[model samples]
Target: MSITSAINLFRQLTVDESQVAHQGQPHVVNETCLDLLLIEMVQVLRTSVAETSFAVPHGGLPPSDSLELPQSSESTTARSNEEQERATELLYYKVERVGFRIGQRLAERYAKDRPRFTDTLDIVKFICKDIWIKLFHKQVDNLKTNHRGVYILQDNKFRWLLRMSGSEGVAHATQQAAPYLWFPCGVIRGILANLGVDSTVSVKETNLPQCAFQIKINRAV
Candidate 1:
């Protein structure tokens, strides 16, 4: 969800001032903790970063040819490693921050309202509409899989992949001159956490066959 929406949800769920010191326990979670968490994020985001994680390294090194020239192959491999190490962090950060804020807001809402639901998948759909669809602007399909490691959203359609997954605090190799968007599985963790579901979502997809930069998600069984 957008930052504004998350903030609205959080504000709606806050406890009243009278409930602050009810009984022996604290009625509301401490603001200091939230401040600390935001501070940590600020520290991590102190510098500017690239817009996309799938960016390729400066090009001059052609595809490696082991048989043609051993010397060139070594340099190509070194360049590849360097590019991999140059993973873009901020693109993933934007995605994860969205998820984190959504989860926090949803959690706060649940705590405050004690809402009830009778419709099947109503709450789930609401979350998908507000949170998932808003950021990516793509249709999200619930996937069926062995062990169900993760919810598979087809990246082929919206063309955003590595942007969604924040691994090692970043999504690398997404902004490279790759053809399509690529999201890693790790990005969904915040959604599940905020949705009050279990953690451990996994994406086992490599690139798609025939299609460019396609990957799927599955839940860990």
Candidate 2:
């Protein structure tokens, strides 16, 4: 079965968090945003992915001649702002762990479909196409390498980011969105790790819903 199908099944069979908690120690096995605060935090993080900052501002104020001034929610209290910032970090580590698990399982599953690879490039290609398609239902839009153990994979429509709604200014939107992308980032890292590739993985968003994962191989065994 495809990874996506497995995840969907997990979501379907999973009990509500409150119910699960009442039974015993709750373990999150599905990708569901449970907390209202996390929902907002995800929105903000998705916005930040689109823009550099949390809020964009008008030069001064919109001119009276303007038909309708765009609304912005840039101004926030210090404590709330700090809380969101901290939450964003927490979201990164949380999703990273989940993504890592997904990647490891996915790699193991995909490996059964093909012959053993002779080089790291083959595994990287699998991630760009096979693994990506399983997770996002689409292949990487672009792939590049420097021929020195550095590979770059770009997805024009990153699935997770596409689910997020756009916020006000570009800066704030991008910053908000940036944190949540860590899940996918961790997915890439985990996949490589399971393949016996020691690498440093990083992600960058050039635009909303489009991001790149860069992998620098440290050692392959």
Candidate 3:
């Protein structure tokens, strides 16, 4: 289902603010969070279908002598690793772009009621507490900074990953979780960019139901 449709369904199920929130419970979807979820879901569906359609047919392997070599095993491994990293980074950028747009729109509306920030840290704090509470129904579990423009935001019970099962092993689980993570990573990047901070966002799944997002500021020279 599209995120907008899902959000409408959610709204239809709830009667009022009381239903949306209780004494101390997180909401299933907030304005931006549901939007991000929808974006991620669409991408996941697209990737799955595309991959299925493009599967390589079973065939004989290429002749060893015909294939080019990287000179040594270590060099081949390094080259392979570089390619993998490049692919990973490209994926993050795609996800981050979606989020950045969402953040831009959100920030315009958000600014209507908020005061100006004195520094970049203030904006990060807003994301950690206020913005996060709106999206997740609770503040981030922890926010740490290196005092050198890098920040780590940890969420112990990340809402989207809560229902994910780890029975399939970490690789499979991460595959399942990546789409959901991507949009949020984008959202954070977008928010920062909107706030005039150039930054990169990445996710690390330390364990099931536990995730950390690293936000690194990229200052202009």
Quick one: best TM-score, which candidate? 3
* TM-score of every prediction relative to native: 0.35, 0.60, 0.65
lDDT of 3 by residue, 37-88 (tens): 5655557655643453334211234433456643688866785575456555
Off by over 4 Å in 1: 1-47, 50-80, 89-98, 106-126, 129-149, 154-188, 198-221
Point out the higher-scoring one by lDDT: 1 or 2. Answer: 2
Q: Name the lDDT value of residue 131 in candidate 2.
A: 74
lDDT order, best first, reads 3, 2, 1
lDDT of 2: 0.65
User: Which digits, one per residue and each the tens of the lDDT, describe model 1 over residues 68-138?
Assistant: 65566678788667654554444345435544555555544443453654332433344445444434344
What TM-score does candidate 3 get on C-alpha atoms? 0.65
Error of 1 at 198 (Å): 4.7
| Each model's Cα RMSD | 12.5, 12.5, 7.5
Q: Which candidate should be chosen as best, given lDDT against the real structure?
A: 3
State the lDDT at 212 in candidate 2.
86
Candidate 2 C-alpha lDDT tens digits along 11-95:
3323344466578866544445322333444455445533432232222343323646454455335534655565555556655
Please provide the root mean square deviation of candidate 2 (C-alpha atoms, Å).
Answer: 12.5
Candidate 2 Cα outliers beyond 4 Å, as residue runs:
1-91
